[model samples]
Target: MSTAHDDLDNEHTILPSWERNAYAWTHSVRDGHIESRRMVTDGAIIDVILDGEPRFVLDLGCGEGWLVRALAARRVRALGVDAVSDLVAQARAAGGDFRLASYEDIIAGRLSLRADTVACNFALLGKDSVERLMPAVASLLEAGGRFVIQTVHPLVAGGDHPYSDGWRQENWTGFGAAFPSPAPWYFRTLASWVALFTRSGWHLCEMREPLHPGTGRPASVIFVLRRR
Candidate 1:
């Protein structure tokens, strides 16, 4: 039977949509309070990253550079990379070490950067990008380095939707004027996430689902993987 997942699988990339709306998105999340981030995701992701005691961190797809700035405050060398020019500019303006580069550019060896820890905070949005970027991520880390990822939990984020893979539109109902357009993000099942990492030569060291304090439902999932 035809399903939403099947429909999304047939669609092309959604990068252009994000590129077009980078400014609004960046402005929305600049303060870092965005409910979920303030309540759970921020602490969970930062705790995992700090536990590794990495000297250098590459914050891949670091939208407004909040994570990078936080890492720098901890005396770690951190750099943020984002494809969106406006977002990158905002990050730079905020005194963050940020570069305007896409995941595809990094994967294709156009940008050279290696780190003890590479973190992607709520940035791994598409199936195509994840598949193409995983191998390059494996290569971009120091030996025994870790890759920490914080993404929307597939189950909670999917809610009552079909579990099949596909693209889903962002829920911008409460975001107000800051979010002008809803960007469609690709969704993958938990099995798909694990398989992708395993196939890319990474061993999962830890995984945790951060739950919302109010509802006890998962707000996001964190994965700590080490190159093997």
Candidate 2:
């Protein structure tokens, strides 16, 4: 059984785990080692973003700036923001416009950025941070703009755990040996996610499930939202 204290501790460990594995993660992303990303979720997110016809995009929690580069390739102006210094350095070295700011900083209005769309790709991994971050993100979007999020499908990611929202440990199975300590993430059920969006003053305009080719199950879920 897990206590609220344990949940808090796990949430706190998320950033440090990423800090330690930043290099390994960058390599994996650039080298395209993650099969699910290489085949499905990457394109799924890019497609969704492009479909929005966004002229300017903010890649929230953009790891290593791949999405920024990709969007830039399509002639869409983009800025990638991340809390990990090493990852931001790597992104800058790769010619991406990257900023180093944590979720807390963004929530506190540290970044004065506005965009037609804000994309968070597989990065909303916490409990409180995410809940608070959403409203702040809404302030960063232009009118008639959208907030897009891609995350592992709750049904698939839940595994054998109970179908409820809480903190869960990541094993980082396919990420190889370099990731010594995997981050623990807060899992939200579909209903919880919907409720969060409402509470954060957003309305879910669309929801998409991108499927895994082999398993024919959803690999991830994308939520497209508009300010309420």
Q: Write the per-residue lDDT of candidate 2 for residues 87-206, one digit (tens) a residue.
A: 999999999799999999989998997999999999999988899998999878999999999998998999999999888888777864478677899999999999999999999999
Q: Model 2: clashing residue pairs?
A: none
User: Candidate 2: minimum summed lDDT over ten consecutive residues — where?
Assistant: 173-182
Clash pairs detected, candidate 1: none
* Predicted candidate 1 versus true structure: per-residue lDDT over 171-225, tens digit per residue: 5654434665567777888898999999988899999998999999999999999
Count residue pairs with overlapping backbones in model 1: 0
Clashes in predicted model 2 = 0
Which candidate has the highest TM-score of all? 2
